[model samples]
Target chain A: MKKSLFIAAVAAALLMSGCSQKKPEVDMTKQETTETTAPAATEVDTGVNSVVGTEESAGEITTLPEDERMAKIKELEASAKKIYFDFDKYNIRPDQEPRVDEDAQLFASDAAKDLTIKIEGNCDEWGTDEYNYALGLRRAKTVRDALAIKGIEESRMVMVSYGESNPVCTEHTRECWAKNRRVEFELLP
Target chain B: MRFFLILFMGVALFASDATLEIVKSTDNRPSVAIQDASEFGNIRIRQKFFRLVMGDLKVTAHFKVDDRYRESDYDAMIDPLLKDKDYLFRYRFREDGEQRLYLDAKVLDLSSGSPVFERSYRVANRARYPFLIHRAVIDFNDYLQMPSVEWMRRYVVFSQYGKPKSADIIVADYTLTYRKKIISGGLNIFPKWADKNQRGIYYTKLGNRPVLYYYNIYTGEERRVITSDGMLVCSDVSRDGKKLLLTMAPDGQPDIYRYDIETGKRERLTFYSGIDVSAQFTGSERKIVFVSDRLGYPNIFVKRVGDRAVQQLVYHGKNNNACSVHGKYVIYTSRESDNAFSSNTFNLYLVSTESDYIRRLTASGINQFPKFSPDGESVIYIKHYASQSALGIIRLNYNEGFLFPLKGHKIQSIDW
Candidate 1:
């Protein structure tokens, strides 16, 4: 049982390493250029990584120009939207799968190949701020792992929990609370 | 003895109509005269006292002050303008060590050349200067037949962030003066006054086993209020202090619950398939206002406290998250955008329960955790800026705004 547990842990670590390997490839290309050129390239690469992670995870990848990349980013953003939770629950429900799928696809796209994305987890105004923050992180991590499983690079994903501070809906309604429990994606360039 | 007799005689002469009559009232604002008596003692002490009093009165929105008194004006001839009876309010320091400060003021009717209201207040050096002045202003306003000054006595509770995961719950006067740390030693946030008297606070202390804790401010006593698997927060307390409307995710889904404080029993208030949080009681405890994403986006909803039946309150905004309810007034925070990447500015808004008279309170910054004053005439909210957060005040009746910047400290949440 111990040996099998070790083997399973190793396999999980290997999978994470395999997903994170995409980071060095993009970083190496940017470093090969001049200093000023390198920083801009690194930023662009990071942006692309975020775009790719989101796009490919959702199964949409197409190489395009700058304007089209932005347009696609906007489109993917609109498609990804936000996933709402049931009152008090941080776990994403089955009904929110389509929204998460869209977000994962956006992360998986070629245009997002080198971009880094931060998953911000949030909660409704029900619990303590610290617990909500941790809960938010859990929800964000759940989304982050889902994207990783969808082939988005793990190293390109960062997570932060705002807890109950950044509620998109301020009303006291189940509908509002559901909208508030969410993992939102921010592309870092 | 002679002074007492003269004062008694004066009082008897005008006791029938002693309340200051509004001979000529104006939204034009009341002009006030503040005298500097700093030379009687230590200069620093007098200057601090002067500044505190001026700041308090200025923020009231009822006073228009003339700060023409200079350092040389201390021992120099008292300006003729200082004696102008349109409205005269004077404060002086007495030599008695028992009382560090003494304020004597009289609002005189210029036409009659007689003092309409006169009173003397004394305070010790150890006591909060702002509190003394706040009480004085309340007296002044009351004597002027303005309105009630009950908010002056209410305790202001706020969370001050000291370090990462280290914050303290502080109780202070509304002006951010007279602060005392009630709870410290961990990540404590969302410090809400549990009772109407502001004796205890409900806050979440973050650790391995994060739970909601109720702390008594005066007694230094505390107890864990509730524990939840994911999150637990005491959002609002009922008027009679019998029930607490809490947001808890006991089953791993955030939902609103009504917890009876006396019995320590809770009844699930909301059962949304999606997130239902940020609950507040409204309309005689039979109704509840809460936020839900059942519509795929956060919006306001109202429902009967016991029944499953729900009604939507706000439709224009996609994200309307936090709210405070008092009488027919429902004050809530609304986000401007649905896009996560967009600059989502959260602003405080007020709407009547009977009608759709929506009035936006704040315009520019991210304002949240709006708690109505017990009197329901004002609101205190947390304002997040670029680098820091502020404990801000909004006087609903006066339509005025004042922000006390959280200097040398960061704010997590505020309840007054």
Candidate 2:
């Protein structure tokens, strides 16, 4: 009886939520139903939503009309230095902290403050996908946290970890791996 | 379902035109010749079976498979006393009136002209012809008494990067000839088998955070397991399947944690502020092996479950990271040099926990993620070099390796 009631509540919530909405939750009953059906549902839902929210913000960068976004990408390209981390380390190298500061101040400006910036974290080819991802995200988060400290609103920034999937250098040299281990900034409309 | 129907139809249509090049045997291995004389229900059906048999023998590394026999060699093969060959293997394929396929295989003593070992398998589904070779190889291994190739029959679950910033987890045979994409359409990565039976897998999905999800392939049921703020992965599942070794960064520094799957209780395993990820159970599940940057570079490390003591496992490579364990044997990918150019040469090495004996598995190119076949006789890994990405298999005792290119997908991780 309870399972059927929960299922009905979920179906009703799905009907009410429509295709896309701004609210994170549909109904209180829906939460109970989701939890009853999936004990781990709430956490993952929060996770998915947080990513979706960040992506939605990231998508806003692309929405600034094509002309504006392309112009912005061109303008930001010179300012956005790919933040490099020491091998297996995400701590913003003492000398490179200024790069984060300069970019953060520019993104915080009134002209681009509302726009979303995607910080893509990457690793060298050495680590596994699982660890590289963690390392990559930590690197992105380090950049994100530094931007936040530099007064760029946290919501204005998005973190994406490509791990070692996307490599800037195809070579096998330590210099190439060092180049691959970086956080790249991308403007999303 | 619709996508699979199209993919399988495409594969079957393409199967006739595609043929894997037969691998030559490495040095000092026994030269075994598999003679072809199988009569099945259909010519096409028999040819497919023959192809799978060749693939099986080529993968096993125990025999130096000699398939390029001359016309004289074929005439010599029929005598069951083929000279200059260490062993002569023969097979006969028959179809019963009920459409059931039967495979009768025998290994002959070349000089004595006697069937030293024999096995027969009959199955109803000839359409699923891959199983015939799987059984044939297992039986062949049983006869040879080498490390059982039965692990080949199991599934290898992995995540591959798809286009446009998305990834999907897939289940395929060890050779990757048979593939079934279980998860797709979003960013799903790091799939680890949840149990010994390979029925379900634990993977992470990105959202506001990375969340661990447990999915059963057969039942189409997915359960949420755990979630973390920065990163999350079920690196290893305990032998009993009751506990999971997870890497999570709730406090901003990624560390290892033990999550009791049943009780929902979590215990911190490593408190290092640096990075500690890729934890796998070793030494009877009481100890753990992981990759840590606590020493300023990613290297393999070991620690007991409840103990605080940490031990470095590899001394040769400064950047030894990805690894798999079967008993005391550990196969890991280690970077040979810190030079910027050698970054693509992440080679695989085999080491034992109790001893300092380490063996190099690959000589060149970028080889990483060495997963020990469940039988521990061979290691399967991802090899990336130039514009190509491949799945590599290395036979331990033979010092031989084989590479099969993945045409489109770039591999991420794998669990056997």
Best by TM-score: 2
Per-residue error (Å), model 2, residue B63: 3.6
Error of 2 at B242 (Å): 0.9
- List candidate 2 stretches off by more than 4 Å: A1-98, A110-119, A124-126, A152-160, A166-180, A184-189, B1-31, B38-52, B58-64, B69-77, B80-86, B92-129, B144-147, B340-344, B385-390, B397-406
DockQ of all predictions against the true structure, Cα-based:
0.03, 0.24
Distance (Å) between predicted and true CA of B62, model 1? 3.9
**Which 10 successive residues of model 1 chain A have the least lDDT summed?**
A44-53
B1-416: candidate 2 lDDT, tens digit per residue: 99999999986654322111123443776677777667664566655566567668878877778765322222233553466777777777778889887777777767666677888888785654566677787887778786677887888998887763578998887777667789997778889998889989999886546789999989989999888766788888888899999988773568899999889999999988777898988999999999888888888889999999999998877877688887787878887776535436588887878777677777777887788876677788888887577888887755568887667667777888
lDDT of 2: 0.76
Per-residue CA lDDT of model 2 for A69-156, tens digit only, reads: 6787668755777889997778899888888888877787766666778778889866765678878988988988888887887776
TM-score of the first chain alone, every candidate: 0.58, 0.62
In angstroms, the error of model 1 at A7 is: 65
Model 1 stretches with alpha carbons more than 4 Å out: A1-189, B1-29, B39-48, B65-78, B82-85, B93-127, B338-344, B384-390
